[model samples]
Target: MASLPQALPEPRAAGPAERPAPPPVARVRRRRRPSGEPPPLPRQLRASGRWWLGLSALVLLACVAVVATGTIRYVDVADTRVLQAIAEIRSPALTAVAEVLGLLASDPVLHAIWLVDLVLLAVFRRWRHLMVWLGVGLLVINVGAAMATTLQRPRPFEVEVLGEWSGFAMPSLPVTVLAALLVSTLYSLVPPGRKRTVGKWVVCGLLVLTAASRLYLAQDHPTGVLAGVVLGVATPLAAFRLLTPNSVHPVRYTRARPAHLDVSGDRGAAIVRALRDQLGLVVTDVSPFGLAGSGGSTPLKITVKADDTVRADESCVFGKLYAATHVRSDRWYKLGRTLLYGRLEDEKPFQSVRRLVQYEDYILRLFSDGGLRVPQPLGIVEITPEREYLLVTEFIAGAREAGEAEIDDAVIDQGLGIVRRMWEIGMAHRDIKPANLLVRDGTLYLIDSAFAEVRPSPWRQAVDLANMMLVLALRTDAERVYRRARLHFSDEEIAEAFAATRGLTMPSQLRRMLRQQGRDLQDQFLALLPFRLPPVRIQRWTWRRAGLTVVALAAAAIAAYVSAGVLAAPL
Candidate 1:
């Protein structure tokens, strides 16, 4: 028999409720919690790290060696002699090529191009990639500047300089800047093997040409250019040590290991204590949920004893831990979500882990008040100050994803009720999909209310309905789901709500299922529309924004002018 709506009475939530202990399930794996830190990486990366450490140390030592050699040459050789020797090799063709190379690397045009690339990286939220280039670029340029003043090396053939120059001669920064640019650009961009190889060699060839041009034109002594090369190359290698993530190859959505629960670590212990004190349920055993993989929030089935011991019934409670900080990819994902439905969005994404718990808890209670079946919010656990939070709730046993189960009239009715409740309360479940809807004991339940928001716009409500309709369409037919929704919504209202599908984000899983069934949700929704709707405008034009844009453009133009004059200045 199904767990009928009348079978279980709706229990009202007053505060946190202590879960009664039940018998423990046999443990398949008993992973000791990590000492409140990420799992120690395997031997391969550590071994590679040891060798890499040696290589970078060697490079830094080489830098010191170059500085020493340049210092000796500066004292022994006069600038006039250096220029005379370089003059012997200079020709009209070589001089012109060298001047072009210097300008290409040092001119404001290069800076503008670099700025454009950086802006693109930022627009895509490629934080790590951006940091890598910026880190290495800054170190190379700053060190070159520092060395120029400290060494006070004289320039050879000063009259040959076409640009105004004020800095010391040793470590020709044009070489340093351009070399670092080439190396960092190569380091950041990894295309297919053949293309990447060709690109790398081309850039490297340009770097070689740059160095020869500098030497032939008597821009600086050979030693100065050599020192610049060493610094430029070493800075990026060193920056990699400091800036790269500890994990060399990061897999997406990897769950926090069982070590996360290792109470041996202070953070881990703090979390356990928080649960015991705040929630009033003493946890005995904890493990990852079989179905839970890497996601924004972590879901685990925790075994708890009422008396705070293993003696009581080992009741299994579903607990989810919202992390204080997301991995780089997760943060990027949040930004993408905002861009996906900017106008249709009802609320800002949860700002903090605690906020996520707060929002979801509030929604759960609100739905429960409306006699809707959802997981009961048990208690909140604070692991760290405003960073990590845990929400423990009653586990609905024998639950299957609505997509994975048969969607009968009962299921369709239950889904409609959820939509109606949202309408009544002026709230929207921004993400209502087959995965978020679960059926247990013939009763329907909603999960993952993290994206739910209150006083939602009509479009948001329509989105909720459309998504729910799509979810039901998976088990049944898209037309069938639409027909059932017609009972609640008029044809025009349904079309308008589905018009929200202009930029709809159907979960990847649903898309895959739809593919298997030869039904495209996007196409189906489009066919329903009588006419094509114009694209949603994400950015609005405003006077102040326009002025800011104009001001920024003017500033950039002025900076380019200054940089061009600076590049042409001769020392």
Candidate 2:
């Protein structure tokens, strides 16, 4: 037992010398920074600081100079000189040119010219540019009016007016209109290649003819017409320069991740970067929620934390996607899953399905401002390469199944109130299923605003109301639901709504289901028909009964007063 079959010799520990020395550590070479050039400033502050300061100072100086010059008065010699020039050009040939030009400058002709230009712009898909020109033209007119008012200048005393005139006539209307036409025409013809050279010449010729016409018609002095041309040309040219594409800095939005599954490539990395930059969210993890819809909607989830902690009820994340793909099957499924699964505490997905997430946020802000109860919207974030967006909204808690009968009555009433308010604002929630209604902390809230449309028709309003009624009836008796509805609306109005939605057969279907309970709802249903029914008279009879009660109370009070008076008189 002690020998134990001579256990194997204990292994000897290797001497320190026997263990090989650790492999020589590799040294990493540090790259040196370049010596000559300084680090560049951020793009936002790239412009020379002194240049901006100088420019601003110059603008201020120019404004001061203009105000000073405008305030100083001269002897009105310019006005006198203009009258003298008008008197000198009273010849037949010049008169004829002026007359014809004046005729072209008339309101009817000007309107026709504007219409033609508008049509041409629309056809050429240059409507946006055309609108800019039109706005400039209006601005020129307004400026001319202001100038005339400021100068308080009168028209030439020599002209015998053929028509009644009102208001100051220093910057002549004909001159202003003609100037606008010439400038706008030039702007349109130029920069679109030299195809409109003939048109350009025609416009120049017309400008000359119109100036002559103003002189001939004696509606404006030569100087006033000249001033108009100067002002008009200056205005549109300034507007064109200010509004031209070259003048506007291109806004480069970082490419966002695809919201739906992109089988074509790896967009996940790009999406992560976009989420961080655009949405200011640090996405800890991202995973596929589910497959795309048959159409194109894909489902996905993104886990993220805000750069800064957000308010409990406020949105900390925002979902974004291209407007073109927002409602498509692939995008919708992904977006829906994100909203349902994302950790939104008090935020909501926006209702505008056609606008970008940024624009939708703007509209939602407006809705909130208008006292509409809506989910708080968080800023929109783009997930990179995938073009998938994450919208972080206030997560609504305690969402009960719409079909549950035990839903709070106050919640139902609040939902009805929301519908009424929607009607008051000329809107309809097109999708009004119970799933869209949420109850949290005993307060009913409406969600999923993507289907909300403005100024709904009577039929649409009726349908919306009917849908809510149907949903309520599904969980409660029709009689009880109707009584609750009547608290906010008249019986006749409710009946009319039912009639309007009869084609949907929603109310009928609900009533048929209730028929199994032996409830005589046929009378109530008939009362809701468009045709006149005895129930209408019965409703009025109930009102009369209330009136009778009021009269009996008054009589009792009068009799009691008389009895007390007789006893006090000791008759």
Top model number, TM-score: 1
TM-score of 2: 0.36
All-Cα superposition RMSD per candidate = 10.4, 24.2
What's the C-alpha lDDT at position 232 in model 1? 66
Q: In candidate 1, where is summed lDDT lowest over 10 consecutive residues?
A: 7-16
Instruction: Give one digit per residue, the lDDT tens place, for model 1 in 1-571.
Output: 1121232221222112344333443322233335654422221234444554465466446546656776545433655576667677777887777788767556575575566657765665545666677767666667787777766766765436533345677678777777677766555554324664797678768878777776666666676776676666656645543354222212122344421332333434554566666656666766666343225566777776543443443367787766544433344455454444343332344556666788778887876665566787776776654655778787776788887888876677678767866787677777776777888766778787776777877767877777787888787876676656656555665676666654345565566667788778656765764554444343434454456457767976985675455345332
Best by lDDT: 1
The residue-by-residue lDDT of candidate 2 on 374-465, one tens digit each, is 55665554442222344444444344534443554565576566667667767766556555555556655555555456676665676677
